[model samples]
Target: MAERCPYPFPRPTALGIPERLTGIHDEPLVPVVLPSGDEAVLLTRYQDVRQVLTDDRLSRNLDRPDAARISRHNSMFQDPRINPDPPEHTRVRNLVASAFSAARVQRLEPRIHAETDELLDAMERSGGPVDLNEALAFPLPVRVICSLLGVPDEDVALFRHWTSAFLSVSHFPREEIRAAMTEMSRYIAEHISHRRAHPGDDLVSAMIRAHDDEGRLSEYELQWWCRLLLLVGYETTATQLGGGVAMLLSHPEQLRLLRADPALLPNAIEELLRWKLVGSSVSMLRYATDDIELEDCVIKKGTSIIPAADCANQDPDRFFDPRTFDITRSDNPHLTFSLGPHFCIGASLARAELRIATQALLTRFPNLRLAVPAEELKRQEGALLEGFTEIPVTW
Candidate 1:
C-alpha cells in the first residue's frame, strides 16, 4: 500500500487548492477513504490521470455489489444508464452529440450573449451587493440550456432543488435524495408526454422522436436522457461560473489583466476550467473489471478508482508553475474534461457560457468586486457539484 489518506484534503482557503492534491506524489496511486466510507485508489499525477481516462478496463458502472459507492447516497452514480461503457455509451451519446457540437453551440452564442446581458441588466438594476450566483450564474445557464433542451424556464428552481439533492452524498439524508430523484424523473416524464403530442425544434422534441419514431431509445433511457441532460447542462456550468467569478475576484492582478485585454476571455475560461471550480474532485469513480497495473500499485479486480482531474491539472510536470493562475497559459491541456469516449459532451457549451458571461461582466461592470472578503465567502460542500451558493458582488 503506497498510502491512504482520508480523501479530499481541506483547502487552505475557499479559493485555494489543497496542498496534498497540489503536489506531484511519487507514488501517485494511493488509497483513499471516500466520504461514503468505501476506500478507492486515487490517481493524482497528470500523466496517470490522463492515462486512466482512456483505459477501456476502467468502467463508470458502479452499481455492482463489489464496486465502491462514491458517496453513501449519490443516487445518480448507482445507475447503469447514467454512464454505460463503449458501444452502449457511444450509441446514446451519438444521438445528442450534434446538438452539443461546436457548430450547434456556435449558433447558440447569440442567445447566450443576449441572456448574459439580460441577467447583467437585472443585476445592475437591482443595485450593488447582490447575490451574483443567484442573479446571474445560476439562471443564465438554466435559460440557455432550457432553450436548447426545450424545457420551460419556469421550472429552473425545481431543477436546482432536485439536482442539489440528487448529487449530494453526505449533505442530505437518503430519503430526501430518493424523493427528489423520483420527482425529477416524474418531471421529465411529464415533459416527454407533452413533447410526444406537440413536437418542436428543441432537443427534447428530437429525443421524443428518437424514442417514439426511430425506436432507438427505451422508455427508461429516454427519460434518463432528458433528466441527466438537464442536470449536467445546468449544474456543471453554474458551479463553474460561481467558482470562476470567485477565482477572478480573488486574484486582482489576473483580473486586471483579463479586463484590460478582452481577447483573453477564452484563455481565462480555460484557466478557470483547469482550476478546481468546485469542491475538490473533478471526474468521479470507475470500477476495475480486472486487475490493473499502474506506475505505483496493482489495482486488484473489483477495485474502485478516482482519477482526480483537479489535482492532475496542477501537476508541475505538465503545467509550468502550475500553482500560479496564468490567463495567457497557451500550452494548457487540462483534464477538467476527461479523455477518450467518456469526454464531457457539454464542454463546448459550458465554455461558451463562461466566455459570454465573463465578457459581459468585464464590459458592463468594469469595477466589479466582491461584497465581502474572499475567505468569508461560503461554499456548498458535500453536494454533487460543490460551489459558491451565493457570490455577493458590487459594481
Candidate 2:
C-alpha cells in the first residue's frame, strides 16, 4: 500500500492558503488517499503542477481498465468532452466554445447587472441579518445560468439538489449520487427533446441545432454536455460569491480599500479567487499513460496524479508573500483555474458574475459586515469544494 496522508489538509483560521500545504511546498509530490480510497500523488510545486496538467502522458481517460479513479463513479459515464483526449476533446470543446466566449459573456452583462440589482432589492426589503448565501450568492448564478440554458425558474431547486449530489466526495452516499445523476440525465434528455420541438435562443437549443441540423454531436453527448454545464455553471460561481464576501468581510481593511476605489474590483476578484481556495486541493484525476520521471520521483504507469491548484497558486517562488492578500499586487498569474487545454470553459462567465456581484454588494450596502462573529462562521467540510456553508451579513 502507498503511504497516505489525509486528503484536504486543514486550512488556516484566517483567509489564506492551507498551512499544511505550505509546509510541504518544497516536496515535489505527496501521497494522499482519495475519498474513494484510491491512492494518488499530489503535486504541490507550481512547476510540477503545470507540467502534470499540460503533459500528454497524463491522461484524463479514466475508462481504461487500469485507469485510476477518484470515486466509484464510472469515468465512461462522465461527459465525453472532458474525459477523452485530443481530436475528440477538440471537437466537443470547439462546438461549445463560442457559446461561452468573451463576446457572448459581454453581451450578457446588462442582464447580469439587472439580476444583481433585483437580488439586492429583495435583500434590502428583508432588512437585517440575511444569509447572503441564500439571498444573493446562490440565486444570482443559478438565475443567470438557468436563463442561458433555458431551464425553467421552477426547476432551479431540483438542479441544485442534483448538482450538490454530483459534486460530493463522500458527503453523499454512492447510491444517492447515482440517483441524482440518473434524475439529472433523464431531465436533460427530456429537456433536449422539448428544445428540439420548441427551440429557443438558449444554449440547450443551440446544442440541439448542433446535433440535429449540423450533426456535430450525438444524442448522448448533448445530454452529458447539458448536465456538465448545469453543474459547473452555477456551483463554482455561487460558492465563490459566498466565499468572496466572507473573505472581504473578514479583512475590513481590504474591503475598505476595494470600496474606496471601485476600479480595484477586478484585481480584487483575482486575489480573492487565489486566496479563497474554493476549489479542491486537487484538479480532476489524471492517470499516467506510461512511466514518467519528475524532478524528484517516478510515477508508474496507471498511477493517479492530481495537480494541486490550491498549492501552486500559493507557491512563494511564483508570487511574493503569496499567502498575504494584496489585491493591488501586479502580475498575478494564479492557477485557480488549471492550465492547458482543459482550462475551465466557463471562466469568463464566472469572472463576469463575480465582478458584477462583488461591485453591486459593495456599492449598494456601504456598511456590509458579517452578522455572526468571524470565527463563528461554519466552514463546509468533507467535500471537494471548500467554502462556508452559511454567510450571514447585515448592511
Candidate 3:
C-alpha cells in the first residue's frame, strides 16, 4: 500500500473540478489524509458514494476518540448538538421535513421570487461591472432565509461574519471559530426564547411548537435545528445561485436555450446542481460500525469515509455526457445532495431558490454576462465549503 494522498484534492478555481478526482477511475476507494491530519478513504464513483450515503452502518458520530477530525481550525462538525441514532434521526428529520420541505417551501416561493427581484432591481440600477455575488447572490438567499427562519433581515452582515467562522476548515484560528460559534449559538438561543414568548409562523417558532406543544424535538435538537437551518439555508443556496449564473453566462448555448424556452428553468436548475462543485461540506465524515463489504473492497471497522458528491455527480456511468453542460438533459439523478437517510433535508428549498434566482436573472437581465473571465474569478481553492468570493457580472 502506498502512502495516502492529501484530501480535498484541490480544484483549480471556484468552478473547476479537481484533476485528482477526475483521475481516480481505477480506484473506487482511495486512501487520503484530511486537513486535520486524520486518515480517511475517498469514494468518487456514483455507486460507492450512494452506497455510503444509504448505508445505515456508516455513522456520523465524530465524538469518538478514533473518529477523524474533519477540520483542524473549525469544530462545528464536532458540536455535540444532535448525533442521534437512527430512530432519533428519523424523528428529528420528520419534524424538520414537515416544516422545511415541499409544502412550506411552496408557500415560501412567492417570497423567494420577490426577494430575488429586489436584488436584481438593485443590480440593474448599478448598470455594469458589479459583483453579482455581493449584490445579489449572497444577499437574496440571506434575506429569504432570514424571512423563513424569522431572524431580522437587517442582521445579514452579522450572519455573514458568523457563518464564515462556523464553516471554516482552516480559514480562522480555533479561538475565533469558537467565538463565532458561541455568539451565533447565543443569538439563536435568544431567538428561540423569544419565539417561545411570542410564537410566529416562522420555522424557529414551528420547531418551538414541535418541541413544546408536540413531542417531536428535544430542547437541544430544536435549537440545533434552527442553527443548522440558518447555516445551510443561505450559504449553500447562495453558492449554487452564484455558480448557476456563472455556468449559464459561460455556456452561451445553454443561456440561449433558457432564454428561448423559459420553461427549461426547472431542468436548468438540476443541470446546474449536477455540474458545479459549488461546495465541499456535503461530504460529511462517517465512521464504519463494522467491516462492510463493497464492490471495490471491504471497508474495515472504525474507518472514516468521505463520499465526494461533486465527483460522483460527474460520474460518466450515471450521467450521460457529464462534462458537457446540457440544460435539457432530463435524466439527472445527481447526488449533489447526499442520498437516502442522511440526505439534505433542505434539498427542496435549495432547488426552489435556484429556480427563482435563475428565472429572475433571465427576466431581468437577458444580456447578463461575466464581467471578468471565468478563470479570473476568485475563491479560496481549498476552503471547506468553496464558493466564488466574487462573481463579477454585467448586463
Q: Which candidate achieves the best lDDT against the true structure? A: 1
- Give the Cα RMSD of candidate 2: 2.2
For each of the candidates, the C-alpha root-mean-square deviation to the true structure, in angstroms, is: 1.5, 2.2, 1.7
lDDT of 2 by residue, 1-395 (tens): 34788667766553445667766676777888776676787887887887777788888777666554555542323343455677777798888888789999999999899999999999999997899989999899999999999998888878778877877766777788888889988898888888888999899999899999999888778887898888778888888988888888988888888888888898999998887447565546788998877787777888888788877887888878887888887678777777787888889999999999999898899999999887777767655676578889998
How good is model 2 by TM-score? Answer: 0.94
Residue ranges of candidate 3 with Cα displaced over 4 Å: none
The number of the candidate with the highest TM-score is: 1
User: Each model's C-alpha lDDT?
Assistant: 0.83, 0.80, 0.80
TM-scores of all predicted structures: 0.96, 0.94, 0.95
Model 2 steric clash pairs: none
Where's the lowest-lDDT run of ten residues in candidate 1? 21-30
Provide the clashing-pair count of each candidate structure. 0, 0, 0
215: Cα error in model 3, Å? 4.3
lDDT of 1: 0.83
Model 2 steric clash total: 0
For model 3, what is the error of residue 150's alpha carbon versus the real structure, in angstroms, after optimal superposition?
A: 1.4
Candidate 3 weakest ten by summed lDDT: 275-284
User: 232-276, model 1: which lDDT tens digit per residue?
Assistant: 788888888988988898899999898788788888899989986
